[model samples]
Target chain A: MSRFIEIVEVGARDGLQNEKVVLEPADKIELVRRLDACGARRQEVVSFVNPKRVPQMAGAEEMIAELAGAPGRSRIGLVLNERGWDRAVAGQCDEANVVVCATDGFGIRNQGASSAEQIATLAAIAAKRQAEGGPPISLTISVAFGCPFDGEVSEDQVVAIAQEGAALGLAEIALADTIGVADPWTVRKRVEAVRKVIGDIPLRMHFHDTRNTGIANAYASVEAGVRILDASVGGLGGCPFAPAATGNIGTEDLVYMLERAGFETGLDLGKLIETAHWIGGKIDKAPVSGLSKAGPFPKPAE
Target chain B: MSRFIEIVEVGARDGLQNEKVVLEPADKIELVRRLDACGARRQEVVSFVNPKRVPQMAGAEEMIAELAGAPGRSRIGLVLNERGWDRAVAGQCDEANVVVCATDGFGIRNQGASSAEQIATLAAIAAKRQAEGGPPISLTISVAFGCPFDGEVSEDQVVAIAQEGAALGLAEIALADTIGVADPWTVRKRVEAVRKVIGDIPLRMHFHDTRNTGIANAYASVEAGVRILDASVGGLGGCPFAPAATGNIGTEDLVYMLERAGFETGLDLGKLIETAHWIGGKIDKAPVSGLSKAGPFPKPAE
Candidate 1:
């Protein structure tokens, strides 16, 4: 097992996108800045997509542009198409993350494209990014474990998409339990399948705490040799397309678990928790993170 | 891995004991009956503690009397002393669970006895039960991972308590993360240490989701070959002795994870979720169980 794990902060993009209240560009920038100051080395600061489709992400370009040349952190931007990919590169994103829906049902519902069409678009974007030769690209297979519209997603389907991404020479490929419907067994199986196809490509995991299996799945993923995990600070995430989706795994809670399990995350837990509390208050609600709810566990005497 | 896992439904005792509002004795009996009807094989129905100390458990004898000879389930009761043990047997409890603290501080505060004194009492009770041949006793070590007063509890302390219980010929031994301070690594290490001392003795696990690692620890326990898991319906549990100690692992949520991970728990997920919702409504609140919140994961078409 790796002694260290990299946490990709996604609260600014994925977490806030699902919330009912849309924060101003300034708030989004400030949230990312606070996270960075608290040792967030890599983060999803924005998503370059159609504002009409996702109004919460209206000022993605502005958010990224404002954070460009910032100190000590790498900014990632979510892009779903060639156009969005172009926008992310223009805005100086350190990494461009493209998501392909695993099942056709979710692809159509979420992105208005079939799975094949989405894969084709991703292939074009990958080619363009490879030619551009600066901002690295990564692929996230959404609803890889299970889809709401399509109940059971086959491992073969997920691996097929991963293979497409691997062929593009993407830096990383992530499997997202978009609807939080994965057990550890499924997580292990899917991760193994994807790894078998994409031999040396790094794998990341995205999980939601909707059914309360997110932490368990995360642990399973870690045991399966996954190193990069995407989490929201306050567990602030849900699916706009998938019905009844809830929070992503809370970053503070995830960090607590990882650090206790002997994985060095290099993030200050106290500061992260305070950040969750602050943002939750600014949003006029309690944070959904369980560790935030439980306060901090007393550290064992060294 | 054991395909079949034993879930000891603890809603009636551990679940309700932590709630601020007390339920009527009849309501408690009805809760146990419903759990049994939903195929719960073993349950902690009530605790035979002093009514004045814990008024919520005021009707332990009456509740057990009402549940005595109830069909299709084994009822267990918590007993702290010889008096409580006598009451449990008289109330026709199928098993008596006695908790011995792993640290002196928690023992003094929670049970008004040192760890040594508690073990001595348990040993005497174990002798009597062996001679009488009924109502098998089990020992639980609270704060087996870390204690609130004592910062770090030694593995030797936990192993020592398990050794004492093993010498007493207890039917099973459970190590409880009383304050939910255990990580998966600690759980695996502790379970291994205890197993080394008490070979072939059935080991049970009790986890509080206080620090949000309960489900993760439970998964690790299962991977470490643990079969019996204790959980509360609706996540209804908190340690009255340990400040800020929160709910136990939610039974419905745990069952969902286990069954999906290919462990057959012999539990009706739908019925258990319905029971959670019913009880939560009866208490005029929503259930904390995640499965009850998200509804069941859609089963694949056979």
Candidate 2:
């Protein structure tokens, strides 16, 4: 399909959160602005978590406060609990993304909560948002494909979570391959199962490229009628809880695939590669994105 | 479709041909043996080309002669011209794989011929093999997606080559993304187009992960009813003619994707990763295969 697909740029948030190098708030802001300039309409700017737990995601308030709002750009703030939701509201984030886990083991290790407990937390925040009128919220189910400790997350587990999530009237529900263990067939079937249950809340997909199945999974999602996806510039970020967690699908790589295939992502490929290089240098690591290393197709007419 | 998929291991030939450090003949044979032990039934073991042109692919005869015949294992030799085909036949290769390029620029640079000239050479070799009853042969169209020297390769060019190839009654035909510039939708469409022209001829796909679209392209090809695919162990190899040519799609990564999605590949994932590690050690470079770095899904019960 040659339709428009929304790419949620997570380079500043998910891309940097799991990185060892803790970027300065100014550097993080600069990274977000650079990606925004590259036509990232929606971006995950910060995660409202304790600095002790995720040190790299420490500057939620400062990062949000410093970023001058660009028209039509949504700065997404990631939240894990009610406190994180309050922080997102206080920081005036364009939107808030709260996370629930498909497996209890990942929920406990990643956010110090069980799966059921995380859903309860999500329900509470949704109710508060409905009453207090905060930023629109979306729920990401982590380990929706497979788990690091539990392993082989069931389709029933994810669908059941999505069902409970749909009841909350959230803006969106995302199935995340937290450890990148998903296959395309499973992805298509799961997306179908989730779609039958959720009616039309608009499904978003988040995939890690740890095992290199991210692009295949994304392609399956797109074919299964998903229009929104999460990607990181430079293929940055890895889950600290998951062993050998590689970056999310690279924003540049995803753009190259979609644009080449005639799908409009509204993200500039050339600018994305440059942003990858800029962030890669900030982290003192070369971008793992394929487009960043290989350059765009047709050689760009140097 | 949970059908059995045949994965052709090319780590020894296409994988190592463009590498910098040329391995000893014994090492190359060892590498082939390791992959065969991991259930690689058909493998591209060497290329019958001048060592002066491709030093990394030298000692094709010695490597083939050293490999003891294994039951059900077919050792494939890649040939570019009539001389190379003769060498492969003389060397007792179980299969001779001839090359026909989709573009003239890559053919001239990589094989010292134009596209038409390469096709003529392939036709000549096919005729000789038919008359003499030599080893079963296949044709690989390199840079079938895009060329480095000549920008975009059209579907008409590749389909035309496949039509000419099918007329030779070849055992198989492969479409290779030599520069790794293909996307999933294009791959699906092109595979369908080529399949229409080459009736009942088992279509094989070869891809490079240079743009990180290899897994997606492979997934699309499989969805398009392609059962045979070419992949490398440890994600090795690059094209010397194409700038920033990365490794082929890793066999282990492809197997993981297929087996996890309920497709039978008859390949061992653990052994494949070990072979990747073993080969990577010999080359003094880490295997770039995603499964090599992330280990297998479900963590292999470790």
Candidate 3:
């Protein structure tokens, strides 16, 4: 019954982090600024990880510095450990996001720890940030739908993770379909269980269009009372560990479907699609968003 | 809720008609036979229009004759007027389909008549078929959601047209999103209205994936409790009149979604996807079906 949805623009951090090309800090800043201008309030601008491990995210600090204090926009920085948390505080992001993989295989493969250890670290950071009166912390559970190494992640695991995140007093908990293997039924089932476990804590959904069910799953989540969605501009970003995994759901495509389905996203679709095409040209690949390929409905005048 | 859904495969006729290259009749027959082998009971094999007008539909008679005695499959042929209807009867198609455009602009442009005139002609054809003990007649209302030249198409018009089609006692009535301009909201609204007007007469849905809303719209229609759907294998077919128009929703993609959503489509997903890829190679471009591009979910083992 909720009519308003908040879209979290994650192209800069999530998309570019996996892209083969290490985009210049200026390009990342420009992309974030463009997204902000198009009415994106929550922009995951950068991830403060080891530059050696993720060279694509090398300019996190500089990107945050450039995006700080932008009008009517919030800059979100990703923090994986205590060191990353220190960098996020120094960068003065509006919010800090910590991700804990749902499966131990993925946790060790991605964050070099088990899900329990990572959740404990994020809990400590959440406690520290709240006491220090710094930026709020949000928890993202990666591979919430299915894991590449572990395979067939159960809804019970995701619910347990969400309960831990809720007990930590995180502001938001995002269930990520890391490999884009979720269908609508699974999305509904998991969202229902997770919501029951973490009552009153806002739920966010992150989906990949790898199997072309991202939009349908997102719509199901909306019907299940979820308001926050994570998408990337130009459909960039693919999971390196997941086989046949494609990019994240296109922000403009999701926005278009949301608006057409009678939900208010508070984002400009025209500007978002234009930005997608522009950035796609820079990356030297055609955008995979359906709206971009088909153009706007009702056939905009020639 | 209906557990069984019938899929009307239209790739052979609708897809190849609009394609640039002409396929030999033997190839068309092969495609239809393969689709039949994959559990498609309803296949629109060809149209009975003038060969000179539509060079691609030149061998409708030969194609039908080749498929006349196929087991457990009903071959459908399109008939625009008396001549086409005569040809369909002579070809001994299992069913005869006539399309009445919703708007006069489209009706005149596509069928060379007004909506009323075309409806009258189709009604006469239906009566004649019933009296002559010929194939059952089905009506397809093109542009039921919106029109290219006429712009917005009112729900009242569609309801009125459905009322007329219902009066003819046709076997089935299909509401087509001819330009793929429909979203979930519009699909729900139009389907609700049309279903109310034509009670108990089977309703089929035809969706185009132009703006990428086709799959979502189809899902919405299923939630609306419609039992039959029209799809093109390999995601072929585009409207020449509607700008930015794309192909119909892919049969394999729809089957995958429906089966995942717990509906029985009676079609083999593996065979359907394989047939899509095989047919795509014979065409000039890649297949537009998303399932083809992403492969099936769960990666179905190496």
The lDDT values for all models are 0.86, 0.90, 0.84
* Rank by DockQ (best first): 2, 1, 3
Point out the worst 10-residue segment of candidate 2 chain A by lDDT: A238-247
- The alpha-carbon root-mean-square deviation between model 2 and the true structure, to one decimal in Å, is 1.4
**What lDDT would candidate 1 get against the real structure?**
0.86
Write down the RMSD of all candidates, one decimal each: 1.9, 1.4, 2.3
Report how far off residue A59 is in candidate 3 (Å): 1.1
DockQ of all predictions against the true structure, Cα-based: 0.55, 0.72, 0.41
The top-ranked prediction according to lDDT is 2
Please give me the DockQ of candidate 2 compared with the native complex. 0.72
Residues A27-101 of candidate 2: C-alpha lDDT, one tens digit per residue: 999998898889999999999999887889887899898763668989999999999999999988889999999
Tell me each candidate's TM-score.
0.97, 0.98, 0.94
Cα lDDT of model 3 by residue, B1-302, tens digit: 77998999999988788877788898889899889888999999999888889988888888998997567889999888988888888888899989999999999988899999999898889878878867888999999888888877888999899999999899999999888777777788889999998999999999887666777778878878888999998788776764344588889888888887688999988888788877787776677676776666555787
Candidate 2 vs candidate 3: the lDDT winner is 2
Model 1 ranges off by over 4 Å: A240-245, A299-302, B239-246, B299-302
Instruction: Tell me, by TM-score, which candidate is best.
Output: 2
Fnat by candidate, in order: 0.52, 0.78, 0.36
